[model samples]
Target: MAAPRAVIVHRTSELTELLARHGTRGQVSFFLEQRGQSLAAVEERHDRTRAALADVTAGLPVDWRRASVERGELARSVFEPDDVILVVGQDGLVANAAKYLGAQPVIGIDPLPGVNAGILVPHAPAEGGALAEAARTGAAPLCERTMVRVRTDDGQSLTALNEVMIGQPGHQSARYTLDVDGRSERQSSSGVIVGTGTGATGWCSSIARVQSPRLALPAPTDRGLAWFVREPWPSPSTGADLLAGLLHGDAVQLRVESDQLVAFGDGMEDDRLTLSWGQRVRIEVADRTLRTVRSVR
Candidate 1:
């Protein structure tokens, strides 16, 4: 039998993007210099990323097939069940890749180790080969991270590794009917955020910091979701009592009362579900979880 393929995922470097926009490296350097900056740091970071990619590519086992995809192309990229995923970018790229993956094990490699506070990227580039080997051999230590899901009544659905945002497109107040447990409330607010335990330290934490002080956020592996209604306004017709809470059992359902509302996951605004007036959206813990490879050492 052939060894399972390794799908390496990455994003374009800032330097590369600058060069593409300016048409040349010299133009990029000149553009930066005009702004009192030099291209040395950008060039250094780019070089580090290139070196990391080289190290990871060189580390793959001889028998394993390898494939590469950019972060922007993940939506259209296909993965086999046995394929191992290697994400070479910051923590957000792991989240970006997680939604498209099924049960595959993912190894997050930070190209620049010390420079990034990688919450999801736990492996350094030097460990890339070892991680790839372990993943192929089924010997990698795994961490199961919970994810959030949003399903609309019209059969549209989205899953998020970090958090899901339901709101109007332009930061306008969103009106909706929120139903949880056995109770329901009509609310007019800025938006709604549904987050998983793996996202507790992110947007959910920020919402918890100011809105619900008594809410204890879940751990990364916890099978629960935290939700917050941003800037809920209390009116005679709308209530603010159900501003924030934890969702566990049956999904928390929301009915849109605005002209249009959007549901986006993991901060990918371009990829979203459109919810028109009177449309219902159910937010819950995703049936699938992210399997992240952790360092054995």
Candidate 2:
């Protein structure tokens, strides 16, 4: 059996990226100033994030195996059954990490405590140590959040804690035949987003808001999913009648007619699947859930 491991998942601060791109602090300051921004604000946020990380690092038990992964490296990171994930960034970071995890419990540590949005990342950084210990000892309460999965006929699959967007590149309309329940329709639309209850609050909610009655979304704990087709174009050969619906105990299938299309989750564009014409894809609620700590204290 693998030893209990604690994985710290964090995103690179914007200031750090700016410094790397501009080659120096002065250059970064100059670049930001040109855009009417202040370097001080960015630096302050960076310092606070780093301080949070330091406290969390200091709190880890010496006997526990430890590792850290940046946001960009999450898709490539391997997670074990006994691992405990400490997400020390925004709530979105939890979403980015959730798809890769199995049953391992996650602790969301907001680098900035008071300003917390109380979404996914809800804990203060100071609680990292005790939380990990509690999780390892099986004393931590767990909450399950629903997720969605998309699989291609080629044997490739992707999971999302939020939603999966399958579309053509560069705003070009995507051509595909969509299948739901027993009905099917040929569609020419911007894309399709199949989302879970957790995703219903973000992109899915915004997308549904544009509808007349505003589509109802599933709850974070619900196994069902809600999906939408963006701006389905109406024409002689195509139909927009099947634009929105729910997925419960059923999978939504799409066969691509476009030359190229891609599917990505949670706005992580770099990690995506590229599909070709004549490819078939299946989307449904996933078997795996994002297991998170129930309480922050």
Candidate 2 — which pairs collide? none
In model 1, where is the ten-residue run with the lowest total lDDT?
A: 243-252
User: What tens digits encode model 1's per-residue C-alpha lDDT throughout 1-297?
Assistant: 776798999999999899889999889989999999889999999999999999998888778899999989999999999998999998989999888999999999999988876888878877887887787788988999999999999898899999999999998999999998788999999999989888897778888999998999988899998888899999999999987888777678899999999999988989899999999999999999999997665
lDDT of 1 at 12: 97
What range of 10 consecutive residues in model 2 has the weakest lDDT sum? Answer: 208-217
RMSD of each: 1.5, 1.7
Q: For each predicted model, how many residue pairs clash, with residues at least 3 apart or on different chains?
A: 0, 0
Candidate 2 regions exceeding 4 Å error are 1-3, 114-116
Q: Write the per-residue lDDT of candidate 2 for residues 1-297, one digit (tens) a residue.
A: 556789999999999999889999999999999999999999999999999999998898887789999998987889888889999998889999987889999999999766656578878878899999999898998889998999999999999999999998776999999999799999999999999998987888889888524667899999999989999999999999998888888999999999999999998877889999999999998988998897734
Return the TM-score for each candidate structure: 0.95, 0.95
